[model samples]
Structures are given as structure tokens and as C-alpha cells.
Target: MPGRGAGRVLCVSEFVRNVRLWFAPQEIREEGGTPDYRFSLANERTFLAWLRTALALIGGGFAVDQFLPDLRWAWRAGLALALLAAGVLCALRAVNHWVRTERAMRRGEDLPVSRFPALLSLVVAVVAVAMVVVVLTGWEG
Candidate 1:
């Protein structure tokens, strides 16, 4: 029944909602039911953990670029980019997960299933493997 313009408007509105949920805790509290302090604190701690991980990833990228021996320029750059990208992704997902968990708590609903941990594990493993290959191959430039 809606026109294309209406569909576009809906999409834009949904995006705005998601952005607010990710960044605006005060707004979320105003719109949604209030959750327990303990639960909210726990969710905040989890978000902090994710932030730490993101920082570590970014730091590790710099470390690898600075300290790793005998890496070609392109390889170094690629590795750094990969780590930094993973870090950015982790950070973006962190806010999403926090919002989702907070909303679940407010709604008195079961917590949402989380795939972030598994995804983090996979990223770490891939980085490790890549490093191992580089070290074994003695890639130098």
C-alpha cells in the first residue's frame, strides 16, 4: 500500500532508531522500561570488555607493524589493516550487543543469543594463523 518514498522513509527511520539504540542510553531508558541497576551495570561491564578488546586489536596492529621482523611493507600494512578492521567491527558490535541486552533486561525477556564471542574467537585464530604463516615463510621486504 505504501509508495517507494514511504519505504525509504521507513528504512531511514529504522536506521535512526538503531543508531539511537547503539549510542543513546538516556534515550533508551526514556523510551523503554527501566531495568535493574545490577543488570545494567553488568551490561556496561560487558561493553567495556569489548572496548578493551577493540583497543587491544588496534594496539596489536601497531605492535605488529612496529616490532615484527622481516615483513614486507604490503604484508605489514595488510596485517595492520586486518587487525584494525577487526577492532572497529568489534567496537560497532559491542554497542549493538549492549543495547540488545539492556532492552532484553528491561522487557523481562530472555537475553538474546550472542555470536560475538564466537566471532571474536574466529578472528583471533585467523590472525594467529596468518602470523604463523608469515613467521614460517620468513616474509621480508
Candidate 2:
């Protein structure tokens, strides 16, 4: 009987620990007093918004790759890859920003500053300009 329930207990404990680590890591959870739940929810909403943007970018990349069969191979690949890369970066930025913002809020500090928004906008603008050139130049496959 000693080991009969040991595996179940271990699995349950591990699952609980993982959930705790993900939602309330000791470092962030233990720091400072708890902020208002409304603020935490607002931060989470912003995180979801960033993730939605990332998903849109990723979907746009796939649509370009799939729908623009007439586009030249180089142009198609370049645009799609740029979008996909931007999506990847956006997703990572989303997570990083969420964690930083949450930690700062927990510690009663000013939110962390980031230039990723400007950088991402520049990337999208450059891609749009390139697309315009491709359209004007008749770069069809």
C-alpha cells in the first residue's frame, strides 16, 4: 500500500506546482502588497490584445503564402517570411511585456518601458512599402 497511491500523489502535486508557478510564481506573487484585481485583469486584457495582434500577423503571413500564387517566388517568400517573423517577435514581446508589467505592478513600480511597438510598426510599414513596389513593378510569377 505504500507505493500504491504514491504515483497519483506525485502527479497531483506536480500539476498543482506547475499551475502555481505559472499563475503565481513566488517571486512575483510575494513582492509588495497585492494590487487591485481590476488592475491585474486590465493587464491580462492587454496581454491578450497583443497576442491577438500576433495571431493576426501570423494568419496574414499564411494567407499571403497561400492566396498569392501569382506573386513572384522571391516576393511572396519575402513578404510571408517578414510577416511570420513579425508574428513570432510579437508573440514573444507580448509575453515579456505581460510579465514585466505584472511584476512592476506587484512591486508598486512604474510599468516597464518598451520600444517594441515602434519597432513592430516600422517593420510593418517597410513590408507595406515593399508590397507597393512589388505591385507597381508587376512582380508576378
Best by lDDT: 1
Off by over 4 Å in 2: 1-24
Candidate 2, TM-score vs. the true structure? 0.79
- Model 1's alpha-carbon lDDT is 0.84
1-141 in candidate 2: lDDT tens per residue? 869699889957854554454566776687788889999999999999999999999998998889877788888898999999999989877876787787788888999888889999898899889877877674533
Clashing residue pairs, backbone N/CA/C < 3 A, model 2: none
* TM-score of every candidate relative to the true structure: 0.81, 0.79
Each candidate: RMSD: 4.3, 10.6
Q: What's the C-alpha lDDT at position 135 in model 2? A: 73
Give the lowest summed-lDDT range of ten residues in model 2: 14-23
Error of 2 at 58 (Å): 0.3
The list of candidate 1 runs beyond 4 A from truth reads 1-16, 23-26, 139-141
